[model samples]
Target: MPVARGTKAQSTKQPRASKAPSVTENVPPQKDEGCQAKRSPSSPQGGPKKRSAFGDITNAHKNQAVTGKKEGVKAPTNKATRAPTAPTVAKNNEINLKKSLKKTPPAEVPVEHEKDSVPEEPVQQVPVVEDIDKEQLGDPYANAEYAKEIFDYMREREDKFLLPDYMEKQPDISRDMRAILVDWMVEVQENFELNHETLYLAVKLVDHYLVEVASMRDKLQLIGSTAVLIASKFEERCPPCVDDFLYICDDAYKREELIAMETSILRTLNFDINIPIPYRFLRRFAKCARASMETLTLARFLCEMTLQEYDYVRERPSKLAASSLLLALIMKNLGGWTPTLEYYSGYCAQDLHPLVKRLNFLLTYQPCDKLKAVRTKYSHRVFFEVAKMTPMDMMKLEEKLKS
Candidate 1:
């Protein structure tokens, strides 16, 4: 009646075919694909995960479905057991990944936005000086290829302004009279607040002219003022007018006389007044010594005092600056000339000894009133009255010199 009942062969084939449907429903389509095909071709190991990122989850569901049938357990029929769509699963995962990336950087790469928020160097909260040992001399011509040539030119031209015959030329003028004129020049320089370089250059120009021309004591002031005028133009930002200088001289010299002397002095010096001075060397030495402000100020006071001595004209500016610095160091109770000073100045203690003695005599002679301008200027509160400081015992200085 059942048309050959239920054929035994047909019954077995039907059950086996039914099992194939259950396996296909549990496993994902992506897992059936070879790992090579599912991975990115551009990646070396096809990267960590690609289309098969959910392969493990898919396999877990597949195993549960297979075990349920073997153990005679009912397969889950809930919506939670619904087959996962590859497109939907990938989309959901992509969203979660994007959110995680925005939270924080998993990689060590620096963020551009973060770098802009931090400063490269810490800000200074207070005014402070650089370390003394780290302080260095300024080199303005450090980049100039012909810097040595320029220096050599300046040095070579210095002899042209030299008063080698200054003693011979000024027969009628005595050294003390020159000292008095220099003292008055110091007063003029201070009153105008001229640059120290200008003062030194003015003195140099005056000495140069003195070697070429003979002027009376009354005319000396006119000549000195004119030299200051020219030097101010060369070195000062806003040099005082010829009239201002004439007024400083108490109108003792007329404007026409000052003008005449300016022209004559320019002619006598051949307009070659761009010479070096001791101030330049002194500053370099002071920096090397790491000299304090007061020590440097005292050294300057001693150096400017040398202008009063006619004998100092013969010594080189470098030696004069070195001796003055050593004397200032000793006078200020600072250390003596250090090895650094000797190397930079090219003068050892033995070389500085005679010059130091000469400077000591000038300090001793300051109170006698022969040359009082420098002492008077430095005695003010602004200078800290370093000029009034007494010299230390000569015996100790001698021991230092010998050592």
Candidate 2:
């Protein structure tokens, strides 16, 4: 046996040498002394110093970097000794990690079933208003694009100007008195060659003024004349002057009285005289029915007749126009209330039947001597003598309504 260098002999006893060489036998004696001096003093002194597992791994990484190849590093075979405070630090870190996880909420993972269970908002559906002026695009005077919107706006404004049999509120006025005034206004419209719209709006102003202010029969003529003066200014491009209105009234009211009455009427009605009238709506609805000149004239006759009747004061202008046009179509043997008419006029035949029957009854009866202006106006050949035409019988009207 050969004694190892840098270590003390156990008993100074020499043993027989084996045929195999010792592990340090190939190394020179001077290299063994240099390696023993370079090792840490804390290593065991029994034999050559042992290298730590960290040193072996570091040396393997260096070898690989130099050789440009990855070395397979093995785990340490011996149990590692940790630092004195390592267990306390690890336990504290674990407890802190648990507390942080408890303080901070977990991420929200959306579940497919839960997502399906949530209710969605309902979508609102809007009512569609039809465009009836498409064919009149070439006619700039027709205002094709804005025609529907314009009529819709007028229909909306009708609610603001609505009357509720306001004659009941007047102490000095009766329905017959109102009818007489309206009849005279019609004659004034014809005599002055004022637009039909001028007549309708003049009547509207009178009724609206009467609704707000109490009036006597003596001042009624003044009110009527002032209304015409205001309406002519509104509807006529070359409206009749104040002198013309004064002349039409047979000088019943002086210039100052008429002018004063005009101010009174305007103030009472809050200066909002852009009233929706049956005449304008009648023309629009007649166009929707594609009514012939005779049919339209007859419808005009029906609408004008209602203007003189105090009973029709509560009717919506649009509804009155629709009902009048429907009756005209029936009398002419034209089709019943059409979808086009319903879409544009906002009334179906059923919706209009009650008023249509009333209008037919109006035409059926002979007018009294006092209220014959509307009948006389329509009886002219120039008006197609629509008043001379027979009214539709009640039974036939019912049959038509059913159809």
Winning model by lDDT: 2
Q: What is the lDDT of residue 211 in candidate 1?
A: 77
TM-score of each: 0.61, 0.67
What digit string (tens of lDDT, one per residue) describes model 1 on residues 123-187?
Answer: 34322433333322254545344533554464565565455757666767777777887888888
Candidate 2, poorest ten consecutive residues by summed lDDT? 63-72
User: Model 2, 360-394: lDDT tens per residue?
Assistant: 99889845666788888899999999999988899
Q: What is the C-alpha lDDT of each candidate?
A: 0.68, 0.73
Q: Score candidate 2 by lDDT.
A: 0.73
Query: Which pairs of residues collide in candidate 2?
Result: none
In candidate 1 the C-alpha lDDT for residue 219 amounts to: 80
